[model samples]
Target: MTESTPALPQRPWRQRYHVAAIGWTLLLAVLLVLSSLMTGANFGTFLSNIDQFLALLVQMSHPAWSYLHVILQPLYETIQMAVLGTTIGAVLAVPFALLAASNLVGNRLLRGLIRFFLDLVRTLPDLLLAAIFVAIFGIGSTAGVITLAIFSFGMVSKLFYEVIETIDMGPLEALKSVGATKVTIIWYAVLPQILNQFVSYFLYTLEINVRASTVLGYLGAGGIGVYLQRSLGEFNYSATAVIILATLVVVLVIDGISNHLRRVLL
Candidate 1:
């Protein structure tokens, strides 16, 4: 019998990466040049404005402590709007997410339709939505709350469906084999796997809603943003500084709570 020769080792796929790297570098260079030209942006303009920006910074350094007490009511209203909106949105997202999830919803057409609708909703800017609601509701926190709720719904629905898609199929299959109802399977099998992610996203959305609500007040939807607009209009830099600090505190607190919850859940 003839002796068989051993097979030679395969070469690594290295040349393709070098080609890709060169292509990406060229693309980035072209994009940067095009963007700079389009926007008329230059390093010189930025340098010239730097001193004036620092002057404004110096003016805002001394915060107006007396304005703090006056802001408390509006600040509380902002928090309330965020909380109510997030809760309402999270609750509403549950059904939409289930419908949009490909694994959960067997019908491709239905899933596609649901996703399309979700995309439509998400496309509407939060500020525009708030303005519309403000027009309809005639101002106050109601417009802000509804606008935030809708925004959260669109955002959380997308997040929830993505979480559902990423979950392990094993438990889902087992639950199905045991003849559990769809709702029961979701509660016992699906929710456990993705509950933490859901909560995390919810908290993240809450943080965003808080920031958005502040802006919504600019449209007279009602929130701390109304005062923010007034302060800026009046050039009350000290009061603006106070508002900025207070907003920073709220954001940090929410971030801390989100991190703690994620750690415990995970």
Candidate 2:
């Protein structure tokens, strides 16, 4: 009897992946070197600046607690700005998101156009939007509110559409089979599925807007960021430290609230 030829073992697909990964790694290393040379990103400069950075840290170690009282009004204004902006943006995003969702609209051209416009709107940075609004509205919370509204609109619209797309189609189909009107179908079927996600995203956006409004104030858009900018410009590290700590506390509180609400909703 002829000896049976040993069956050759098949190489795992992961072996091929390893070979391709090595090639990509080398390519990325070469590109990184070229980029570093082109950009003059010297590690030595960063090392030298470490001392200066440490000195500033030392100066800010003791925050100016007295300034906290003074910043209360601006802090309140910042919260107000975030609330107003998020409310306006979320309301506006609802209709746009519904229209942009392919599952909801069923019009490929319209959905594509709306998504394209949303993408365009998102590409404009918040700071740039705030600057433009400041120019138009002539400084104050009004410009900040408008900027935050637009920014929140662009972000929430994308998120809301994604949620709409991921929702169970069974309920929607059932509603349609019942010969329900579009409004009734949305109210009874679509809204229930997406409402929780909508609230979750709205709160998340509110958290972001609170932080962003601070920076917007630097551009004369109105909030604590104005004070933050001024303190930094004047080299008042202690006051800046206070602002940073206060902002950090606010962010943590907002995050905690968001987490609680998400748990309840989920």
Candidate 3:
């Protein structure tokens, strides 16, 4: 009793609400509300029109099973476009990747320029590429192929260079000490370590291109998406459902294969 401690003062209710998380949450909610208003998003109108949306959903649920045959050829074409495009882009990416790698390229100027060019390429949207190519190539798999090739190139080059830069400098140093040429060093010291990773990345990019190829066709680039656009224009929701389901199946299969290969390689 001779050394009794004083009671601690409690924070006020207003102070309790002064946490960083609460402040951030309130700010985010306010921003969302303002954005919605500015964008003409009327939730009340959406709620009122829910019945029509439900009806459309009900129509899509019952897919046209017999329409699967109609899509098979175009679906195969889509796969072909994806495969061709990914392969072309991957091949083109190798030299660019070698040039861009910091460990491989001694010239900072060259590396920086390559990186800047890559950044510019990567910034171009896939849709815009598709549209431009369609205008040039006149609506066929040619447009689709070129668009995918460019898209894949921009993506895969960056991935490859990053992989190259992370490789053990030990092999490179040893080769350089022995007076090995650049090509020999790259072939003997560089390729072996990064090959698996490169393949893994190629497979991943291929998976993305497969999906992108379909979308490109919607803009007259020639794939299953052409049929998809047609179906939507005709208001044939059942056919659209079938097309979507088929695309999902193909994507799932590719994903499964890609995952299995990655596991084995990695």
lDDT of 1 by residue, 1-266 (tens): 99889888765666646777888999999999999999999999989999988887887998998999888899889989999999999999989998999888999999999999999999999999988999999978999999999999999999999999998999989999989999999999999998888988898898888888877888888889889889989989999999888878877887788778777876
What are the clash counts of all predictions, listed in order? 0, 0, 0
lDDT string, candidate 2, 153-264, tens digits = 9999999999999989899899899899999988999999999999999999999998888789999999898899899999999999999899888878878998899889
Q: What digit string (tens of lDDT, one per residue) describes model 3 on residues 160-233? A: 99999899999989999999999999999999999999999999999999989878888999899999999999
Q: Which stretches of candidate 2 lie over 4 Å from their true place?
A: 1-19
Pull out the clashing pairs in model 1.
Answer: none
> What TM-score does structure 3 among the candidates reach?
0.89
Give residue 57's lDDT in candidate 3 (0 to 100). 93
Q: Native-vs-model 1 lDDT? A: 0.90
Q: What is the lDDT of residue 91 in candidate 2?
A: 97
lDDT score of residue 226 within candidate 3? 97
Taking all chains together, each candidate's TM-score versus the true structure is 0.81, 0.90, 0.89
